[model samples]
Target chain A: MSEEKKIIICRCNDVTLEEIEALIDQGITDIETIKRLLRIGMGPCQGRTCLPMVISIIARKTGKSPDEIKLPATRIPVRPVPAGVLVGEIDEE
Target chain B: MKNRAEVIVIGGGSTGTSIAYHLAKLGVDVVLVEKGYLGSGSTFRCATGIRQQFTDEANIKLMRYNVERWKKLSEELEYDVNFKQTGYLFLATTEEEVEAFKENIKLHNKFGVPTRLITPEEAKEIVPPLNADEFLAGQWNPTDGKANPFKTVFAFARKAKELGAEIYEYTEITGIIVENKEIKGVKTNRGTIKADVVVNAANAWAPILNEMAGLDREFIPIKPFKHQLVKTEPLKEGQIEPLVCPPAWNDSYVLQDGEDGGVLCGTGLEYGPTYDMTPTYEFLREVLKWATRIIPALKYAHIIRQWAGFYAKTPDSNPAIGKINYIDGFYIAAGFSGHGFMMAPGVGEAMAELIVKGKSHVPLDWEWYDPHRFERGELRSTAFQIG
Candidate 1:
């Protein structure tokens, strides 16, 4: 069943189910390096829309339950903010 | 994997993996043990600037060798590590910085690295988006560039594995098995793996590992200093090829090649030697203030994340490499300060030579990185460091 599915798992990074599966096949089970490599869970959404599915993909590959997998650390600014605003340089546009 | 090996390399960052690859290439039974996943340490968190621009002869020569290796690393490792020689541009703001660039350029010239002191106008031609009026002059080197840290690290690791070296990730080293001041092996969470030579490439965790081997701070002093950086969303490839940074006075740099195209900017927060990885909002403002000043267009970009990591800083900001005189079969290659990722190739190659032939063939090689030199009160000049 080597089918090319266009299933998008990490929308922020445009990471797909096939892409995550390929990394798992390479034995990269750690979510940190996985995120670093594929840019998953690192976009503006910050894993809000994709982390659950990404974790499930890894868990299924590693033979662990979805709940057993830990989510990646959430970064600051919980929502995306223009960097200039932080320095008091608000864009009029 | 195996219960024993001829050499046990601790850590799995760029340094440790590079050491493992070089050692394995030299035909050694090497086993590298890491506390976390591969490249989970500072290697993954580095600013990804590789350059030969330094203020000292020892550093200049070492980095020259490193740059040569970096240029051909992809073909050598049989992996695309994304190394680009887009060159690195240093903004000389102060009169003193301009003078230092002259001497440093001459030193780099002697070491066969073609770094030139250019005007601010010439600097803007290299990076079009740069706000040129902020700095007085510039230091331009076409050889210095950037590489994806994780890709380079994994290339070495994967190649090392292909060369028959066992790399145990997520395998924590609980203790060092030393007998009669000689390295016997290491006690890991997995089990004991015996080896004649044990290399402490543990980066920020080097001091603790050395302590387990009974080589205290008095023996080889190293402290961890935490630094933070932020990366924006990718724009377009090759938009910011050269790494842009202000000189010795300030601690910030902007590069467009952080993540294929994401404009990356970094700065050291107001902190001393500590291992705190908390990315603060204050730092975001501080780094952005400098970054936007350099390239005003960056203000429009959104930062995807802000992450922090440690710089295993020696007192002199140089790495403690080579065999430790205090321990019989123990070697160290940590405390690279902030430039370890860029220096990994040179350090790895020279260390491998020293281990196999008992002496390194490279210039300013492993012996110069005397681990116990601090104990003797002989400190080296700090390398030219920027964010």
Candidate 2:
């Protein structure tokens, strides 16, 4: 079976392993840290895929618990809503 | 009959408003001019995800400062920004991806951002509904969360106004008048206003403004890319927790929006040739597919709505900040891609510090984001890429 064709994280930006490792070597060690460092997992998807992988890497390198690392935050419109919808609904609440 | 301010700002988006707020707090006579309502630009259209995990110290420090301010934004401004620390999670599916996460976690720790790497199992523990078999590893930061972008922007603007700053909305800036290598003032629809300095916080429109000032800044080959997000009917029970998926593998993210009851969801829509912000059937299908794969429960929810916005992209996927070398009293806080909202306050504080104290305490190197860097061919690549 094609090894289940692993899911590549950071898809919106096409960030690969080599690039991420280079960032680490350059001194990035946390997912949140790498986020600001490399802008990983901050895309429109908001770290949904690459975040898991980012956590594993940080855990292995830093020897700190993954639970300790904070996750990247999530914002509203969970799905994209049109500007009109946002604007028109101003009085909905 | 009016007092000529020492500094004038253009664009009332998060960057401009925050910069005005910070400068006003420092007792600077600043006027913020916005062509439209505040936060009407990238601020309102942002994903509002503030993160500290970074490969560089400057970014880490910038986010660290912003995150700190976000936590206290409501209290400081006496307006609830609804800043929520919903926590963020990043998942990696390959060895190559895992390596990058490792390095980033270390850097965050060094910089004092509480970030940690987690196992797929542990990741599932935090976000109980995730499909653990889908990824190799993940990263987590509990303090990372989202806030109301509109209220956040308003909060800053209101505070700045109260502190003696004049914010002019519905006023468009036509150009920056530079005389003898120094800023003369800015030309707007309302007329010309003289000032010693001008900062461009126009977000996606920054390049045009930069060109107006005769400064050469690529400001990230930003094309207004459209993205889609959906909100479901309010959940009957606690069926969801706020969570973000690593964009590397998943196209969608699922999170809860506090007592608002609806589950907020978003995804990087597959790229299309045009910069159109219109919604498409293709995006809806893609979002449903990924949302189901990551969080199977999403299958039960009904998507109540959808919307679109633009991200100011860069060639290297990073932001262009700081002052222009060729122009005196000209600065930038643009090209944030989509991270502008989360990074707005910090960008504001940095610009304010630079403006008031003539330097930043966090040492954001002016050279890295120098408008001339692209000309010198000294551009660096970035790892984060999303729609």
Candidate 3:
């Protein structure tokens, strides 16, 4: 482990594997709490890229199965939408 | 889990965690229980702006102390809470708004808060892309700032735990045990925790617990109002440093968050005592409409996420922060309408002070925040509220 290079887990927020593992060791099991603390899942991708890996890591570390781990609720506008487009810009004649 | 503690704090949001931390710091044994993860409630969902520019002197004074506590919070917790005092700009678009802000500035100044009325040009300088034509004047208070909502609450919980406070997350309080009008303990899903003093710091969910503690319907008028916010994909930092609020336009506001440069904006408070956390399309569209109006350049910005949270409002938007008159060991530190995150540190300090030492050094009319104030028809308007 000491010889290994620092591994990044959440690419959008640049959160690391070590960081996630560290908080897990501190007895923080919930991904939601971890996400808030590190802002890992709150990026442009909205945890889509990082959550699976983080969950697996959490499950492996905490001795909980993947099924037992709580998943964050996938919020709306699943794909990113431009702010201007949402502002009734598309005129309805 | 400890079966007995001197104090039991329900809810683990900003206020609850801070109250627990402050209590523990004062040598009181505190146990904090949360139904979900800490700060996952309104604390995480609310907009990230702490301001002292209020129309009411009491609120202005309370917020002044809250800002001071937030400044020291990072150092005090030995954790970087990312507290930055970028200041908050409340814009005045109409003559009535300008006149109202002028009065608010005077009141703010009286409390040693250096809030000043600035020209629209100065406001545009602060938030460069600000629609200069809309506002005639702005109230800028340099000390009003924001800290990381998540970090702030978690730091408090961590420090409180370090100080021998027991923090139980995922432990839902099933019932409150009261014997002879005194709080005996709380019944949680896990088990019973015997605490003499029970604090209903549960925010929007506080009324339920108040009812469990035998509070009559009349006493438990605390309701939740739905408020919504949207965050754009990381925009450039420094473009919008201050929280630019236009009270004239449905209390709409926009500010760039420091965490990832996402421009967070709000359409303002909704009027229902709503429990629904569903992010509405109408809310998103309205926020986009008003936020772009505030800064025309933001039209191109991409929205990454939208969320809804409750205000857990009282008869007044202000919170009930002291001991309940009827119940012996029952206290309240919740119901901060929309300003709970900003007010948590001060609430914690004041609530702890009230419990341990019988008084708080922080200057506020204590009776104003009392839980029983509603009975006397003493509901005062929340400062700087547009509607």
Candidate 4:
């Protein structure tokens, strides 16, 4: 309920625009590097909403084509799963 | 006697503006109208991938001609469309797909498209990061390319306007005035304009527009199918190069805007029939999952945004590109499904030729793409990956 507009650049990891900008300012402008450093678009939602916005900002500042940007890796089941299921303990013999 | 045109082309996408330009170039008085902003509909929604690899002779011919035009689009239109010849890699991951690609390549080579059947190693050389563990081969057409859909549409509209053609924005065509099997004019939300010819170039809403003319519902079976695209932040210098189209793993395609360096990616999801424009969470999930699995390097590529657009499906995947059956001066340029952008330049010119000179010089068998082909049980399965 925070009235602040959370610039959720990565719906998967709930990364914010401010965080991405800070990383870019720190000379970590590469999308892959940023993902490795901050785990931004690595979550289940992937970089769906945030990918283009970040690309636009970078392109505006650096004058690059969105095509030059490397596409994010796709995972299986492409959808999200329940945390309970992910953490379920298996029977030990 | 005032503020009238001989032909009023509806919809402001590439098809409409291009038709208007060709007509005006042929000294035909033309007026182009749009309900929304120009290039905002399917044109902007397009991934802008253009290629010349099809399973048919006529389509290959049309796309080949379009590629020729795209080469000099900037010079002809006097504006830069940002046309990039980064080549297209249609990856095949199965034996069946490889068999299909053989036929496609045969047709392409027959029509001088220069598509070659390459081994997975060749595809890996081009893409480098492709998951080549399981795939037969792919069709690589180096002359195939991508472009800026928005800029191209704007360039067409600007050129059309310069040639004594009137373009009205924010104007909606509510009804078409047809009497005695002839088009009289169109009734817009603003006012009525009389015209001798009315071309329905509205992409997704083409069926509804045809209904407005009181045409038969079976005149064109154009249905809407939604697809999603996502983009990532700019990559480091040499991670990936050029646009990628994988026919094996999924119905997914990838392209990077050279100007922005952001990776624009899309996939034809298994979406059933629906006109809703809402971007679903499911779409995001599937697109990202495939992007990661196919190119493992994109595992961390931050997704910037996602969007959805509709494809107007015809009984055949090819569009209904000519005149309506009995309605004089009522033509159709819709039902491109998802491949409209690639064919826009050539289609516009062909439609213009049909409108002005009664025939097109592109040498396409007009009978196959005709709107009347459906009723004659001459249905064509030209489109296979219709997501």
Candidate 5:
């Protein structure tokens, strides 16, 4: 029987480890550039699920500390909210 | 470490990359520095609508040249930009809007833009899903369309690199080294780069860069506003036609993505100046209400994702593109408001010409878009600004 393909990274955008490795092989070293090229951390979750994994991958491949591999800029509203809530249409639960 | 370049452009969005490409093509040693990835700013979040329809002649003429350039962009850049001239349909709901469109079409025709005021039935014929009864008339322009922003920016970046331009990613410009009102160089997080000329194409973050050079007061009129857009699940191709816009309906617009069949929709929410790019549920509810009302079929479409971006809005809703007279080698190409992506090509070509040849090859009144216009109380406003 054939082995099942493991889905380990970027489940929101369906970016796998193999794809990330391929981009790294092509001389893309920056985490932000990789995110833009592969749309890995750009899904609705906004990199929450896969950013740490991507940082580790880059650190390992580049032989640098994870701290040296800077993460992408994080903007406000850390949590995704419905449009209504953003516009002050708060529901009293 | 220290580096030297003739010109340093401080942004990696479409405008900055295009400027770098044009400058490199002109044989100028240019380096483009991006704090983030290319197109990670407003370029990636744009609705990608490229239209020539405008109320003012200057804007129409600029867009006319831009549209022409967009048509041959793929060939010039040696990359497929996926520019589809699917047409733009501007619906008029009231008699007042119809009258306004009549004048708009007249101006459009004067500038050689092939736009015509069509009846409600003709509008339906173009976009079958449109509710014809909701509109009185619509102005349709066949040449207006959408392009893939990611491909377009990469095309410019690749071409620029091919033409001997250096691009530095993950490089942040922390300060501008200015002395006696002359640009010396830019201090970056990576290292200080000595540059005689500097172009501020930072878009939403233009104010910060301008402030670093002590030119913040001149750029005070430029502000940032957050706009949200939602994408629905991919549907059958040809289910929708043309970018349908109801300007009278709070500046709401809808279009189907060319690469993916997802229906993209958004509206001009009355959000104040903010750096927050949070997608609001109010925007989703409002956009869907207006979208489904226009195309009833959209009611069944489920929103897969929503995102927000900042528009570097100017007081006049027009861009500030020209050399700053007070500063010798500092050029401003920042205040594009919401239409930077559409206007990037023209602005790039003009800025390159001005920098290399000391004047634009195009017959644009460069003084009209001067960065110092706000200080002089001279503002040229555009009428057809949608969210």
Candidate 6:
């Protein structure tokens, strides 16, 4: 189970459990702050891949429930949309 | 932490970083603080449309100067900003809009913008995929272009740092210390920095910073509206000619990104003032509805991502620049209403001149953008504002 400490949590941004622990050691407890510092959830998936893992990591590190730690603000287009589709290009069936 | 700087510019977005770069170039001890990483605010999410096609003479002139600077920006910053002068095409569907565009073209021409009112046929020549039947006339400016916002902000920040300006990211400004209406310093979560000059280039958060300075009622409130934009998968290079804007179609505009060839698009739909950066499914539907009609080829492209950013809007869409009379050395370079990213270079140059020489060397009428304009009821609004 010691290997889990070095396991990658955010595959999109290449964030790992050890990296999150390093940031938490620097007094960065908030999920949003941790996200900003480590780019934990700012990747293509917009935290979908790593947010749950990060919340659990934070919860375990600070000895608190995952519900106690506030979730980061959810922003637009929930899924990754191509740049071309943004201007007018829609996927034609 | 050095704990002191001659000038503390809050918010390390396009505006703040530009100001810091310019001030540092002029040998001012400037310190820039950002709550998040650089360009993490509206800068990262901006549509990156750079245009000089404005109805008002002031805005036209301001953007004209900005576009000129943009032309040489990459060379000056020693970075490829991906500035493509693909031109901005404004399609006028109604006769009234066409007539309004003719007047705007005249104003643009007077300011050396080189904008011309072209026939529908000519518009199609510029953008081959444009549906000529949809519009009566088109206002085309060949010089107006788009820049890579991320690269541009980093270029400025890098140059500023190289010139001895200190930038602190992940630092949130909590309070402003003003003694007897004179500028003293600012209190950040990190520590209090004693600064004689403080410029609130915080965009959407400018009003809160203003309130912290004890000048709550002095400046007009800058409300932030969630402006959403979507990017499609990379298309073939040179497939689209320029930024195709159909103002009549809910102010929707589309352009191909020069760096990645992705079709970047947005609309001017008013979502009111909110901090919600969540992109709505409705926005995607609405933007596509008009966009597909304008360029039928776009219907085949797949949307890759959608994101929302804030447009710090004032009562008048124009930004508030210059120092307030009440607060000594407390300056403002915000409230751009989505145009801040495009006007960053011009605003940075002008603000630096104002700070160093006590007046703007640029020909722009800085008084029109004074923070007290709302109180004096001298609000000057621009007619053409693309989302």
- Model 1 per-residue lDDT tens digits across residues B1-387: 699899999999999999999999999999999998888878888889998888888888888888889989999999888888888888887898899888878988988999998998998888888888878999899999889888898899999999999999889999999899788999999999999899999988898998999867557778887788888876777667888888553578888765658887887564657777888778898899988988998888887778888888888888898888777889989988888899998888888888899877777554457887888898887866764
lDDT for every model? 0.84, 0.71, 0.85, 0.75, 0.83, 0.83
Which regions of candidate 5 deviate over 4 angstroms?
A1-24, A29-93, B218-220
Q: For candidate 4, write residues A25-59 as lDDT tens digits.
A: 76556665456445555444565666777787666
TM-score of 3: 0.96
In angstroms, the error of model 3 at B322 is 0.9
Task: Please give fnat for model 1.
Answer: 0.76
Provide the lowest-lDDT 10-residue window in model 1 chain B: B360-369
TM-score of chain B of each: 0.97, 0.90, 0.97, 0.95, 0.98, 0.97
Sort all candidates by TM-score, best to worst. 3, 1, 5, 6, 4, 2
| Residue-level lDDT tens digits of model 6 in B11-122 | 9889999999999999999999999878888897888889888778788888888888999999999988888898899989899998999888888888798889999999
Tens digits of per-residue lDDT for model 3 on B1-387? 899999999999998999999999999999999998898778998787888877787888888888888888899999988989999888887889888888888888898899999998888788888898988999898787777888888899999989999999989999999999889999999999997899999989998898899888568577988888888888789988888888778888888887888998987757577788888888888888899999998888778888888888887778888898788889988888788888888888888998888898977568777778888888878645421
**Per-candidate fnat, comma-separated:** 0.76, 0.02, 0.84, 0.00, 0.03, 0.36
| Clash number for each model | 0, 85, 0, 37, 6, 19
Cand. 1 TM to true fold = 0.95
Better of 2 and 4 by lDDT: 4
User: Per-residue lDDT for B96 in model 6?
Assistant: 98
DockQ of candidate model 5 = 0.15
C-alpha root-mean-square deviation, each candidate: 1.9, 17.5, 2.1, 9.8, 4.1, 6.0
All DockQ scores: 0.70, 0.02, 0.73, 0.04, 0.15, 0.21
lDDT of residue B203 for candidate 4: 81
Candidate 5, residues B267-338, lDDT tens digits: the string is 888476888877776777888778777887776565567888887888888888898887889997987888
Per-residue lDDT, model 6, residue A34, is 71
